[model samples]
Target: MGHEYAFDWLDQMVHELDPQRTEPERLDNYQSIAIVEKAASEKKRLILLFKQFVFREQKTRQIRNSVNHYLSAAVSLMKIANNNLNQIPTKANNFRLALESVFSCLSEVSAFIVNRYRSHVDRDISLNLVNITPDAHDLRTLGNRDAMKSNLKLSKLVTEAFSDIFSDHRGGEITMRKLDYWVSVSHAVTYPNGLLEMTTPFEQLELIMIERNFNSPLFVKYLVSKFSEGIANSEDPSSRVQALTFLQKTFNQIPVMKDIIFNNQFEDLTLTINSWFIQEINFHSERSGTVFSDLGEQTQKASKKYERKTSDKVLCNLTVDQLSIFFKAADLSNIISARSLSAIFQSVAPYLSTPHRTDISHSSLRVKSYSVEERDKSLLIDIMTRLTEQIRDL
Candidate 1:
C-alpha cells in the first residue's frame, strides 16, 4: 500500500498485457512491447536488491521494494499465461521463463522468512532493535526457556531474520570461524557504524552460538559446569540423560582436559549425577503418571488400529555363534548339559549357517564383559555389579 504509484503502474501494465484485455495484435503492439521491456528493466534492479537481502544485508527499503516487485511480476506473468505454465506460447516464452525464475527465488526467500524471521515491531511500528538495551537480568535469563513474549514480539529482529539464512547454507565454504560468523552477522545488522550501535550480551551471544553448534567445546564445558554444580534445577530427567550421554560420547572430543576430567573420574561423575537425581527420578515421581511395579510378561499382541509403522529400536549385541548355540538349545526343548554344551555345539556346527557355525569354545571360568547398553534395566544392574571391581583393577 505504501508503494501506491508502483502498484498502480503494475495493475495498468498487467491489464494492458493481457491478451483478452487487448486486440489479437497485442503481441506486436509497440506500446505493449515497451511496457514489458520497462517491467523487465525494473525487475532486474529489484533482483539485485533481493539477492542482497537474501544474503543478510540490511537494505530494508530495497527489500520491501523487491518483495513488492516480485508480487507485481508474479501477478502479471500469471495473467499473461492465463494460469497455464505449460501452455505458454513461444511468442513470449522468454518472459514466462524469467517470471518463473523470479517466482522460484521468491519462494525460497519467503520460506526463509517464515522459518526464521521474528518481527521486531508492534502495530507495524519499528522497534529499531539495536537501540533497545538489556540489563544483566535479561542476559542471565536468555534461553533458559523460550524468550519472553514481549521481547520476542520485538527483539533481535536482524538476528532472527538472518539466522536461518546462515544455517540453511552452512554446508557451503565458510571463510571465517563459526563464532566469527555470528559476530560478523551481529555487526552487520546492529552495529553498521551509523544510527544506534549496540552489542549483544556476551552471555546471550555465547548461548546462541552454542545452540547453533551443539557440539561446541563451550557447550560441553557449560554442561559439565551445570551438571557438576551440586544441584539440578530443572525437574526434567532428559537433561540428565542428555548431559551424561553427550559427556560419555564426546569425552575425548573436549580437547585439553579429556583424561584429567573423565578418564579416572567415573566415581565423581556418578556421584554428581546421583546428587542431582537420586531423589527426583524424573516426572514419573508424580502420582498422576502411570506406574506398574510389575508389567509381568509382554505377551505378543496384534495391532488393533491403524498406527504409523516405526522401526524397532531393539539393539542386538550377541554374536552369531552365541545365537546359534541359543537356537540349538531352543530346538532341544531347553535341555542343556553344562559339560557337553560346547561339544554339542561343535557337533551341530556343520549343520548350522556359515557365520553361526564359525566357532565354538567352552569356558568353565568365563569372564563377563558388557561394553554397550541396550536399554535393559536388569542387564544394566548385572553390569553395574562388575563395574566397581573393573575400575578397582584399573
Candidate 2:
C-alpha cells in the first residue's frame, strides 16, 4: 500500500513536467534523476555520489516547484512515521511495507542532482576522473566554465558528510585537498573492484529512512526495534548501553517528537517508568495490606500478587482528587517508591499541575528528570533494580 502510494506520487511528479512543452534542460534533468534512482536501487554508494552532485548543482540553485516534488514527498512520509511509532502496524508488517516508498522516492530525488558528470557516476575510477577533470580541448570535457565551482562544492560536501569516518589534515587543522583527489576517491570506492563500501545494518536502514520522507513516530519505533537485535546479540553490557545511547540520539533527531520530548525533559518517560512503579506499588501495597484497612490479617496471610484490575485502571485514569490522595498517602522510604511517586505525579500533573508537583516534592522524595540520555538510563536502571529487590516477596 505504501509503495503504491509512493509510485503514484512519482508518476504525478513525472506528469507534472509537460513532456511536449518541457524545455531540454528541465526534461534532461528529470530523466537523469529517474535513471540515477533506478541504478541506486542496487548500490548505496550512489547515494553518497548523489549528495555530492546535489550540493554542486545548488551553487547557482534551481528553485522549481516540479524539482522539489521528490524532496517534498520523501520528507512528508518521514514525518508521518516519526510522529508516532506505536500507531504504525508493526505486528502485521504494515510499517515495513510503507517504508518501501521511502527508498524509491529518495532514489528519484538523487537523480535530480545536476552535475556535469551525472551520466557517468557508475563508471570506473579512471573514466570518472577523466570525466570529472575534463580537458578544455576535448569535446566530452566540462569546458572548465563551472569546473572550479563544482569541484569546490564536491570537496566541501564530502568533507562535511564523512568528517567522522574520513578526513584530510594539514598542520593539525582540517582543510580542503586538490579537487581531483575528492572526485577520484569518491569515484574509486563505488567502482565494482574499488574499495568495498561496507555499511552497518543501522547505516543501511538509515539510507532508506530519509528524514524528509520517514519522520513519523512509527519509524522511530521501527528504528528502536531494529537496534534491539544488536543489543540482544551482544553479551557485553557496555555494548547494550551503546545500543540504547544510539537509539536515544536517533530518537532525538525525529522532528515530530523532538520539541515535546526535549522540552519537558521527557515527561513521557516519567509516564513509562511510572506505569511499572505504579504496578509494583499496587502489588506490594495490596499484598502487605500495610496502607489499607484489615492490614494485620492480610499481612499475616500468604500474599498473592494483587489481581484487582479495576483499581489499576482507576490509577492510570486518575482524577485530581484521587491523585492528591495517592500523593498524600505515598510513603517513599525507598528509591523505587520515590520514582513511582514521580511517575504517578507525571501522569496526573498535566491535569492538576502546579500544586501537585509542589506538594508531592515538599516531602523528602526528590523526583528528578535527567535531561541527558546516559544519566536517565543509568538512574532508571538503578531504581528498577532496587525496585525488583524491594518487591521480592510480592
Candidate 3:
C-alpha cells in the first residue's frame, strides 16, 4: 500500500514536470500581449497537487507522518527531476520551472508542518534534506555553475513565498528551541536568524493565548517574561511600542489576565513595566462597578422567559438550603425576585412536602442559608453536572 502511494505521487509529478507539456504562452494575458504575467501557473499547480497528496495521506496516517512522507517524496522527486535535466528542449525554461515547483512544494510543506505540529516535529527529519537539492551543494562545486545560479534564484522565490505566512505571527504549541528551529528552517529558509533577532516572541505567544481565549496560565507566564526580554533587547522604538500595545490590548480584553499580571509575584520585573500594569489595574478598578450594571442591562434586554426558565430549571432540584447557598454565592439575591425564586422551588417540590414556604420573602430563604457541608457541596456538583449534560444533549 505504501509503495502504491509512492508510485502514484511519482507518476503525477513526472507528468507535471514534462517539458513538452509546458505552455509559456499560456502565461500571456489576453488584454495585452506586451506584458507576460509573472504568475507561475505550473508551480501553483504542483503545490496544489502536493496539498492534495497531503490530505489524501492523512486519512490513513497521522498528520505528522503524512508530512514526513511529503518531505521524503518531494526530495526524491526533485533529485530524479534534476538527473533528467538533459531531456529539456534547448531554448525552454520548463526545466527551471519544474525545479522551482519542487522547491516551492518543500517550502509549503515545511511551513505547514511548523504551523500544525510545532511541538511534535522530529528535528532529525531535517537531516534527510541534505544534498537533496542543488542548493544543498557547497559553493565550491565550480562545475555546477548553472545549478548554483538556479539555486540562488529558487532561494529567493522560497523566501518571497514566506512573506505572507510570516506577516502575521503563526500560533501553535512550541518550545523556545523548537520555535527557533521553525523561524530558521521555515520562515527564514536559506538564511535563518533566530526568533529573538528579527521579531519578539511575545506576538506569537499572544497568538497562542488568543487561540485559547487568553485563558492559558502557562502562556500568561511566558507572556510576562517575553515582554521583559523584548523591552530589554529591542533597540527600535517602534518594536518596543508595538510590544507595549500588545500588552495593553491583552490586559484590557482579558480580565483574568489582569489579575494574573497584577499578582504580587511579578514584582521581580522592571518597575517601569510593573507601573504600567499598575496604572491599568487602577484605571480598570475605577470602572469595575459598571460591569454588573452592564450585565444587568444586557440581561434585561434578553428574553425574560428564557431567564425565568433557566433560573427555574437550575433551581428546581435544589433543597431550600441549597437554593439559599447558591443565591448567596452567585449574589443573585437582590438581582432575582424573591417571589419568583420561591414560586419555582414550591412548584417543583410541593410546599407541604418540602421546606418551601407559601409566601415569598428573602428573609425566609436567608434564614435557611447555612455553611455548605460535604453533602451540600456534592449535591451542588451533581446539579451542575446534570445541567451541563442536558446542555450537551441539546
Candidate 4:
C-alpha cells in the first residue's frame, strides 16, 4: 500500500511534467521508490551547481508540495484508523500499522539523504528537502494524543520508529567519519566549478549540520573539548599550534558557526592564552610596513621594467604557451635542472592555484599538453627568472 501511494504520487508528478504522457497500470515498487530517490539526488546536484536557478526553485517547490501531500494523506488515513477502532478493530489496526511503516520509511530515507549529501547541499536548500525532509510534526502530535487517550502501544511504536526526524533531540546521533577506511571513504566535499571545497571531515560535518539548521551539540562539545585540550597542552608547542591553526580556519571557513562551535568555554580558554596578541601585532606590523616601506615601490618598478623589455617580456607574465616556449629553450640549454623542475612546481602549485593530476612529470610538458593558469604563470615566471639569474651570477 505504501509503495502503491508512492507510485501514484510519482505518476502524478510525471504527468505534471508531460501532460500527454499515458500512465501505466502499475509501476514496480522498488522502481517507483528508486525513481523518487534518484530525482532527489539529481535535484541536489542541480541545486549545488545552480545552473538553472529558476528551474531549481520550481522543482524545490514541487518537492515541498509532494512532501506535504504525503504527510496530509498519512495523517488523514491515521485519523480514519483511530475513528474506526471499535467498529473494525483488526482492519483499523492493520491500516494504522501500515501508515506507521510508511512514516518510518520516509523519515529514514530523509535522514539518509541528509547524511549522505550533507556536505554538498547548501544550508538553506538542505533545510528544505535537499538534505532534510521536514518531519511530520503534526502527525507526531496526533499520535501523542491518541497514545494518551486509548492506544498506547501502537502510538508509542509510531513515535519511536521515526524519532530520528525530531529536531534537537538526537544530537549524539550525528554520523562521524570512520578513520579505518579514511583513504578510500573520505571525499573532499566539492561544488560546481570548484567554487567551494572542504577536504577535512570535521569541517565537512560542521557545514553539513549547520546547513541542516541542526546544532549537533555532541559534535560541537567534542570539538570544543579537543580545542581546549590543544590550547592547554602548553607542553607541546606543535599540539598548541595545530589547535590554534584549526581555530583560525574554523573562523575563516564558517564564520557564521564560530560562536556555536567555539562557545563561552572556548572563549574563556582562548582569553587565557596569549597567541591572539601575536596575531594582532603581526597584522599591524604588516600593514605599517606595506604603507611606509620602499620595498613595494621597488617591486612595482622591477615588474614594470621587466614587462617593457622585449627579451624579458615573457618573464613578467607566463602563460602555458609562454611556459612551453621557455621550457623548450631551457630544456635544450639545460639551464634548469630537469629532475628538480617537477618537484619545484609541485611544491608551489597550491599557492599559485596551479592544477595538476597525481604528479607533474617532464614528459607531460614535452608536448605542451599540460596547462597552468595565468595567476600561477606569473609566479612561475618570477621563480624561474630569479633562478636563472642566480645561476648566471654564480
Candidate 5:
C-alpha cells in the first residue's frame, strides 16, 4: 500500500517536467517550478486522504498504513521543494504553496492520529460499572424506566469492552501504545464522574460512623472492630490484608481529626510519631510533618499561646522511642474495647527498654546533671521483656 503511494508520487513528479524547449533558462526554471508545485500538491492530497481515512469508519490497519505512506511521501516532497527553492532562484508561488501544504498536512495528520488514540486511554478501565437505575417498583410506577435500564446496560457493555480491548491489546502492537493514549483519554472523559464517585464512598463510611455519635477515639475503635470482622469473614488473603491496612490507616487518621477539633496544637506531635513509626515498621518515612506546622500557622491568630506551648513541648520533649510507643499502642489488640490508656502504657513498656538518650542540661530548672546512662539500657531491656511476657500470657 505504501509502495503504491510512493510510486504514484514519483510518477506525478516525472510528468511535471518539460523535456523539449528552445530556451534553456526558461525551460529549466519552468521545470523546477512544475516539480515543486507537483510535489506540494501530492503532499496536500496525501494529507487530505489521511484525514478522511482517520475520520471515516474503516479497517484500523489499512488506515494506519495508508496514513504512514502519505506522511513519508509528504516529507520527501517537502525536502525536494526546499532544494528546488535554492536551485531555481525564482519567486515561484508554487514552491511556497507546496511548502505550506506540507506543513498543514503534517499538522493535521499528527493531531488527528494523536487525538484518535488518546480518546480511549483511561483509568476508569479498571473501575467497575455502577448501575444507577431506580428500583423496579419505582420504575414501574414511573412508567419510563425500561429505556433507562437498556441505556445503563449499553453503557456497561461499552465500558467493559473498552477495558477488555485495552487490557489484551487485541488490535496488535499499535493498540499497545494506544493503551497509554487511551488512559489519558479516559482520564479526561471520566474525571468529573470520578470525582463525584470518590465523595460517595467516604460519605457512606462517614454516615455509618456518624450514626454512632462517636468521638475520634471511639470512631477509630468502631472502624478497627468492623475491619477485624470483615477480615475474619473474608476468604481471600489479599482482601483481608487490604481490609486490615485500610482499618489501620483509618485509625491513624484519628490524630488528625483530634488536631482539627483541638485547633491544631498537637498536630505536629501526631505527625512526628506517625513518621517515626512508619520508618521503624515499613523502613521508610511517609512524609514530613510540615502540614501540621502549616495547620498551626493557619490558626495561629486564635490559638497563638496554646499552639506555641504545645508545639514547643511536642517538638522538644518527645523522643523517637516515645513516639514508637504511640504506634505500638495503636496495634495492641484485635478488639477496639481491649485498647485503653493501660494498653498504651503496656505497649510503651517494650520500647522503653531501649531508652533514648536523655540530656537534662537544657532543662529550665537547674537540676543536678546526673548520668542515668548506666541503668538506661538494662532498664529498657527489662521493660521490653516484661511486656513480651505479658503479651504471651494474654
Candidate 6:
C-alpha cells in the first residue's frame, strides 16, 4: 500500500505540469506563473535604474571635461591677445571670438549639467558657471555695442587678471611688461572710439614716465616726441594749453628733456612768434598804437605811489591792448600764439620789470613807445628772453 501511494504522488506531480489539467490544478499553476512574471518585471525595472545611473555618471564626466577644455581655451586666447601687442585689434577680436565660442560651449555644457542633475550639483558651482555667461556677452558687445557698464566690467576683469600675473616676483617683470604693452595697445584700439575713449597713448605714457622712475635717456626722448605729437594734433586751444601746462609741470621731473625746452637752436618756438609780431605791427599800426598807449597809461598809473590805491580799486581794468594783444596777436603774428605764452608772461611781468614812469627821461627809458604790433613784439621778445634766462639758471 505504501509503494502504491508513492507512485500516485509522483503521477499527480507530473499531471499538474500538463496544460489540460483539472480546474483546481490549473488555478494553482496559473497563480505560480503570475508570481514568476512579477519577479521578472521587478528584475527588469532594477536593470533600467542601474543603466540610467551609469549614463548620468558618464554625462557628468563629459561635461566636466568640456568645461575644463573651454576654460583653458579662453585663458589661452587672452594670453595670445596680450602677447601680440602691436596687433592688438586683430588679436583682441580673435580672442573675443574664441572666448565667445568657449562661453557658448560652456553654457551648453553647464545647462546640460544643471538640467540633468539639478539636485546633485553644488549651488556655488552653478553660480560660477553662470558668471562666465555674462562675461561672454560683454566680450561680444565690446566694440560693436555701446554698453559702458559692460565694457568697464570687462576691462576690470582683464586688468585684475593681468595684475595677478604681473604682481608676482619670479618672471613677473616680464609678464608685467607684456601686460603694460598690451594695455597700451588695447587702449589705443578700443578706447579710441568708445565711451571709455582716452587721450593718445602718449598721455598715459607720460604718466608712466613719472610713476615708474624710468629715467632713461631713450624714454625721455620718447616722451618728448609723444608730447610734441600731442601738441601738434590737439586742435582745441584749451587742450593745447593744458598739454603744455602739464609738460611744464612735469618738466623738472625729466632732467634729460630740459634741452628740448631750453635749447635755443632746437626749439626756436619763441622766435617763431616774435617774427610773426614784427609783421603784425607793420600791418595794424594805428590800432596797435592805441592799444599799446592804453597799456602804457595803465602801467604808468599803477606805478604812481599816489595812484596805486585808485588803480587797485579798478576792476575789469585790462587795457584795450591787453585784450587786443591776445585776439589780434595771432593775426599780427603769422604763427598761433600759445595762449599759455600770453598768460604766463602777463603773470610774471609785474614782478620782473619796474612799473613805467612818465617822469623818466625818454633816453633813459628802456621801454620804447611803439605801435601795438611793435609793443607786442617787444613784450614777447622780452618775456621769452627772461624765460630763457631762467631756464639757463635752472
Give the lowest summed-lDDT range of ten residues in model 4: 177-186
In the range 1-394, model 1's lDDT, one tens digit per residue, is 2343333444444444443444333344454446556656655554444445545535654444444454435434444434433444557644454434433333333333322322211111111111122222222233333332223422343233333324343223211122233443344223223211122221333333322333323334454564445225535544544444343333323222111121111222322333333233333233224332221111011111112222311223445433443434343332453212233443343333333223323221011111222434345455546867899999
Name the top TM-score candidate.
Answer: 5
Summarize candidate 2's per-residue lDDT along 1-394 as a digit string, tens digits. 1122333443443333322333323334445555445434533544454455445444322322222333345444334433323243435233333333333444434333323334322111112101122222121222132322333433333334333222322212111122332344333323222111132333322322221123233333444455555557756544444454444445434323211121122234322322333343345455444453443243334132222233233323332343344353442212123223334454434333232232222122222321224544455456558879989968
Q: What lDDT does candidate 5 reach at residue 35? A: 54
Error of 5 at 4 (Å): 1.4
True lDDT of residue 226, candidate 2: 55
Off by over 4 Å in 1: 1-6, 15-33, 40-91, 94-185, 188-205, 208-394
For each candidate, give its TM-score against the true structure: 0.23, 0.19, 0.23, 0.24, 0.25, 0.15
lDDT, candidate 5, 49-131, per-residue tens? 54565566367655644544444444444345344434432544444444344434344444444444433222112211111
lDDT of 5: 0.36
Q: How accurate locally, in lDDT, is each candidate?
A: 0.35, 0.34, 0.41, 0.36, 0.36, 0.35
Assess the local accuracy of residue 162 in candidate 5 as a C-alpha lDDT between 0 and 100: 41
Instruction: Output the better candidate (3/6) by lDDT.
Output: 3
* lDDT string, candidate 4, 346-381, tens digits: 222222211223222333443352454566667767
In candidate 4, which residue ranges exceed 4 Å CA deviation?
A: 1-74, 82-163, 166-214, 235-249, 255-394
RMSD of each: 25.0, 24.3, 22.7, 21.4, 24.7, 34.4
Cα lDDT over the full model 4: 0.36
Give the clash count for each candidate. Answer: 0, 24, 0, 0, 7, 3
Q: Report residue 360 deviation for candidate 4 (angstroms).
A: 60
> Lowest-lDDT window of 10 residues in candidate 2?
122-131
What RMSD does model 4 have? 21.4
> How displaced is residue 89 in candidate 5, in Å?
10
Q: Which residue pairs collide, candidate 4?
A: none
lDDT tens digits, residues 96-131, model 6? 333233333333433443444443432112132222
